[model samples]
Target: MATFGKYFLIVWTILFFNFFMETQAPPSCDHGWTRTPNGEACVKMYIRPPKAWHSARRACRDEGGDLVTIFDETKSNFVRDILAVNNTTTAWIGFHVILTEERWHWLDEDGTPNYTNWRYGYPDEDFWDPMVRAEECAIAAWVNGLGAPWINYVCFVTYPYICEKPLPSKCQWNDTVCLNIHETYDGWKCLKGRDGVARIVWPETYPPGSSGPIISGYALPILRSEKRRRDLQ
Candidate 1:
């Protein structure tokens, strides 16, 4: 019983440490960018005078992209990576309250508010417009440009637009499968078997077929079960 208690305590301590480490880890990237071995898809805009939200959208559209939309982990990581790399505290994103109050939308082909990555205490109507009932919104960098933080800005104030261009796909390989490492993408690569041996392939050199350690920066390795192996093959 004492031994079991000791082991339990050890396991609990390890779990607590892991949780703290994960929580304290630095943010991987900014709010609306993604990273890839090939390159990065960034929310690029100028640091000129302020612009309204609509104007900002137009500027991004003109550049073959929209303001910015972080729909998933890939996009989120990409943005975080860009911000960290540039040491930028904040920047503009593609989100604004359009017809409805507090109902944000992205100024892109899909003008829907599918996802949001706003920081704490955001979308505040600090600067109100009597003429417009709905509060206009735009991404602001460095919190009023005073300090290095994120803030929401009123639309109609002209600022440079940030755009996102899709990155081209690259070839990726995994222990069990070969996948097309395209931009804006995600998928699994391997699975485990009942035997406990991870069903991974390290292809033999100069054999019947092209085989080697599947290596693609984008490709992920996974373990497969016997049943999955048959189906995948």
Candidate 2:
């Protein structure tokens, strides 16, 4: 009896420590976002209804992203769970089939992932009875809170929308201009930022007196005279 009691106490202590540790652990991402249980991407659900698909897309763009772009079943399930939790009947995703082009594509800033999740018999284009210009948007439908399916929605209709964006890597924050160095030398790699991401300075892409290329977060404009000097030479 004594040995059994000691083992039981050890198990109870381990369980208590695990529960306590889990309770104190921070959320997977920043406060505003909910990291997917599968650790795919952070997701957010906007419950304000009556937002047109275009309006929702523009709103997401203003937030530095487009509408949520689900990559696979894991992300789809996570997003559907968000809708169920928020009781959102429908929410826009970053997809549409232009009538003229007639090929489904992602409208997100960085383009779509290869995977797709569609309700069986989806993209019918004639759902809800064919009007002249109906069913140009895609939505996650969880009106029943279970067995959610991706369905086509009218572009003008209003519904809550989901916006998804990739979490910043260790090196993305504080965004120091990669061009601030006086003279970039070969093999000049050094750690920067709190995450200690190694940044290497290379001038291979930045040609002297040429501004045809634009690097993200930096603006280097060459004067017309400089461009003309190269042209003449």
Estimate the Cα RMSD of every predicted model relative to the unseen true structure.
14.8, 17.8
Each model's lDDT comes to: 0.47, 0.60
TM-score between model 1 and native: 0.42
Residue 96, model 1: lDDT of 65
Provide the global lDDT of candidate 1 against the true structure.
0.47
TM-scores, all models, native as reference = 0.42, 0.55
Model 2: per-residue Cα lDDT over 74-174, one tens digit each: 77777878877887667888887666555678875344348877777886656434466564888888745445578886788888888775553322233
How do the residues 1-233 of candidate 1 rate in per-residue lDDT, one tens digit apiece?
99798677656744533343211121232444443432434356444654566766677677666676666555655655555555555556676665544456665534555556555676565545556565566553543323322356655555554567544222122122222212112213322222323223233342343222322222133323556434433
Worst 10 residues of 1 by lDDT: 178-187
